[model samples]
Target: MPVRQLADAVERVAPRDRRVWEGRLPVAGAGGIAVKVSPVRARQLWMVVGMWDRAVRSERLRGRRIRSAAALFGRSVLEVFWDLAQAGELRALEPGPGRERALPTATLRIVRDCLGIMAGLVKPADGAVRLPSVEQPEPKATVRAEVLGEVYRGLVDLAGAGPLERDGTALSYEDRTRLLAMVCVVLDAAPRSGELAALRLGDLTAGERAVGLRRRQQKAPPNRAEEIAALAEVRPSSVRAVLWGRRHQVSEAVYQRIAAARAELEPLPEVEWYALRPGTQVALRRWLAVRERLVEPIQGGRSALWVTLVPTKAGPPGVTLRPQGLTQAFARGMTALNWVMAGQYGWEPMPTRMEQLRRAITVSPVPAEVVGK
Candidate 1:
């Protein structure tokens, strides 16, 4: 019989009989009979066959494997049908109460079972044939604006010098700096956590017009540059400078304390220049100066842009803030903001609340003369 006719016959045969026939018959002239295979089926078949070949060569498959040329040809035909079944191209009657329902469906186990049957038909040149492994599904990405706004608000509250009380407790300076740094970087750079965490002190360049951040792309090809907008209001450069100064301040203090106890130590390195807009520069400089007097200088190389000043028993007092740590901080801040806003406003959408807040800030105070009139 011709190869195409035999393949068609195999496809039409009952499941039990088809298996019996597959074990007895051999395939030939597959190249000439390529016209019989549909494009989609052929593609899936090629993938399955390729996987089987790799498994055999890697010795992943042991014992009897598809080695006969005729059997291999017949195996390809079975593969096409198996691929169809796995892809839900074949329908089965799903027994229901009072009636039978026909639907196209294939479970993961069913697909693997069909693959196992196909594997049995082939004799590998070296090892036995093994079933193909399933590929994992990719995770879906989602963005929640309300949660983002809460995190932003938390940072703003922390950055303010005035005591910020949430639930009758004042926030610490350490919490303020960490939250502020995360908000500033994320708002300005709009980079993923990995890319943000990988940023180095040298990667930032502040020009006369704007600041530029140069870092290797985490999700793209090497050498591709990603442009990030610098919001005039956010003042990311200013935040960066403050973080740098805090680290130096902590390190200097530690050195001084050690000197008093035993011997003198080398002076800490100077903080680098971080350019900012005319309006923001003075405020940031003043903040850093005050921070120097109050906070201890940070210890370590301080090469990483993001570092936590809060002392902890887990490790060193000064440690670099990782991507995961930053994410967690942001989440916690968001949850706190949500709780506060929900209580005061009695449940409103975040966007509406933000709009109201914006309007309140932008509203100019009436003059004394206007009020008197």
Candidate 2:
């Protein structure tokens, strides 16, 4: 369906709130209470609805087609979403050579969210579709202790070897240093890819023995008006008290309790600090020296600790490294290590998963000290 048509369908069913049509989609939350969502979510809702609208042939239903989200309440909207998934429309289509792919867990989730909200709008008690259980992704395979030892040794050897000029290929020495530092950190501290990517120059404090990591908040806290709106629905008495207290004095004890509640609701920092092993610290320092020469300080006086070692279409070298970049670097480094091992030691290729690397470190009897806490 055209975007305009989907927008029209959404507008027809959406509440009178201007924001709902303009930017947000109001979907029912846990108890069928409405929660606002981004326009991207709104698009997903209509995508499923459009499939339904096109499939329905009954003149009465087809003419009125999804006139309201309530039209989807007890309907086969979930089935439609699944059908699309099976057809390789909802997500990538990578069926086996002879067989169709099974419905993905992620598509299952999308169906549940889209249809569930529609159900909630009509039936508060049963707001969403009761979906079949989704299969969880299998955990990364653990590298054997001997294999891990060899892999670590290979990486250390490669890092110390500096840039390779084999096959007349020009490799970035800075990138190799960065990947070594990242692998060392991952083996010792096991920070999430995002945390590692977001590390800044200032995050490495205490002489780089310890690193502080702050995870940016993904969801914004409710604004004052939103809080009041929620209180009106869930805690009417408290809302009333707050409203009354604005014009009149409340007891000191009551005031203190309210203050405590407000403080408890306030967002807390998502910051963490991890102690680095001596080896990990040394790797980081080496990378920092390479980074300092490759990247000059801008007017802001500081930048991301890890940066692109090579130019990209987006820009020249020195752009801040994202989580994807870190993953790619690890993959490339592992591939190079495999080539070296295969040529020299005649060993089979080892697992190159970063998750498995971290897991291997975690499950070892004498695991590398990756965390202080």
Candidate 3:
């Protein structure tokens, strides 16, 4: 159903932003530019609004955020409500897999951003509900670099052992090689899950010494109106208000300031070429060989660097593995790694999340020699 239709009867009759239905809601972004959200973000926005609408109709939403959403949008209490209690619980309310697990902080942040956008679409009301802040969990403590080094050593040994023993936890020979390469890449380059998933066979250099990574821009730019409002403290309030109302009227100085700040804050480039460690290059080469064999059966060929090990509902063994699949496989690989180091002394269980591993690597970088070993 169209998001506009999800609104109350009075709201439905009001002049609607057609892009709301198209799922390409234009948000004022940095420098007063009308920033269009990526499709993924648009879908997420639709999902949150849908969820909020359902919660309102069921009277399950009661809290300051919903009240604020209503007041901010100049809508009635019945017309706009979000289940802040449910969201605050840090679990998915929907009855499905992963409903019990606490939602990722990133997911919660996105939900908050989406709700704010929805509120911005409407005229301001008399009252206000400050958009609630997401509850942040304590940062996961990173393990020592020596710990990751030892784990990497174990993984390398496992890969060099030729074929893994057949068991429920055992991965296929092809998958084993692929997992090793993935681990090596993560430890060496620390690509995000999305960036890793988006990798293609062509991303590899001629000699496979490095991988060219293209960052997917799934996130929309920061709200332009909000930034302008903030700048009102430094700039003329009247001019800031004018810029807020007319995004295109934003000054180049404002654009340069925002751009500079963002560049400093987000140091990661949109595209980066990371040189692979010797061990990483070797593992990648091995995976490439195994991957070639796997895709040989397919008529046209596959471009994805990572392919499924076995037939799935999506396709045969050679089909591109989705990001979720890659993550699950990485977890299984971690289990296999634990199995390899079952009785080893001076070793701890490796962190399962890629983020944790990245942090550990950043804190104490394992020497290239340790990685190659």
Candidate 4:
């Protein structure tokens, strides 16, 4: 059963899911918007189970919708599923409890998520698109000022966040250190789980380098890492920024950059056409879903720094978390602050945990020789 689940996870996320459903959104002409459209697997199963938007195309995936999922890159539906379920695409013939049951809810959810993930996997200047009606429009650059502002505000707020305030500030020194250790662990866990970015609260100690920062997210497999790390050979400017960052200082800078980028974004046709909202907004709490308030120290008296990584949705289990040591004292120093908590944590899926760590721990490589230079 364990191996079965692992195999399912792999098959579900295999290249078949990444490839466009050529059977559905077949190529038309050059200069198309989305060179290809996403296909549904058990995807329609989601809509079959629960609520969904009225705008989706249910006709596209129907009887004989899928073939197989083998050699999927160039292979067709004939490979994967013996009878590819049209669960990703379905239309209700009747209200409820009818002989005509649509796709399952889980399938529909999978389709949507897969589409989103593969959307970015497209090749640049992939091709042009032709719609049912209306002439093709010119490709234009989007200026997303609002998007930028939203990202900026969210990061700054997170950075400026206060302690859990469980009992009171006078958190015994032992408690502070324990919290710091948890923070490091949490940061390492975020991105792999599938959220966004994450960081540790810090100031590089004198001549300390090689510290790493990483975060994890939820949508990914536990073993796949989605974290970011500080470049080993970073410029002096970046090192200074880390060394001097205050509570949420790095967040503010990150926000400033995102805000600048958002200003240049605009809702693309299909990208926003069937979207839930013209422009999606990410909640900060969604970013820090894993959290716990422990008045007592989990570790008796070990010398390891931890950051609080709170996974979204199910959060991390208290008993299963473990922290790794970094040779750089600066990262260790930042771990002592307890102000920063990376968005990573969860021992059930160990890979997701490391994915988060990879993001929260940044590896700043100062040539070891550059130090004297």
List lDDT for all candidates, in order.
0.39, 0.59, 0.62, 0.28
The CA-based lDDT of model 2 is what? Answer: 0.59
The candidate, 3 or 4, that scores higher on TM-score is 3
Could you estimate the TM-score for every candidate? 0.35, 0.62, 0.69, 0.23
Error of 2 at 366 (Å): 18
Q: Model 3, 254: alpha-carbon shift in Å? A: 7.9
List CA RMSD, all candidates: 24.2, 10.8, 8.3, 19.3
Give the alpha carbon lDDT tens digit for every residue of 120-152 in model 1. 333343333334445544433333545455545
TM-score of 1: 0.35
Q: Write the per-residue lDDT of candidate 4 for residues 161-232, one digit (tens) a residue.
A: 544343232333333334333333323222222112122212112222212233211111221111111222
Q: What is the lDDT of residue 194 in candidate 1?
A: 55
Candidate 1 regions with alpha-carbon error over 4 angstroms: 1-154, 161-171, 206-299, 344-373
lDDT of 3 by residue, 191-306 (tens): 77877888998877767777777744333223433453354433444334343332234465665564454444534345567777788888999998988888899853399998
Model 2 segments more than 4 A misplaced: 1-64, 73-75, 90-126, 165-170, 215-269, 297-301, 343-348, 363-373
| Winner on TM-score (1 vs 4) | 1
Predicted model with the maximum lDDT = 3
Better of 1 and 2 by lDDT: 2
Off by over 4 Å in 4: 1-59, 70-210, 214-296, 299-304, 307-365, 369-373
lDDT for each residue of candidate 2 in 1-373, tens digit (9 for 90 to 100): 3323434545545534655465545554422234675555666666655545544433334443454444444445445545555455543335678765555566666755565454544544534344434566777677765665577677778887757655544446776788788987776656667777888987776567877766433322234324643533434344344432221234445445544454456454465566777877888999988887667643321478888877776455677887787887887787777767786663558665676776666511121244332
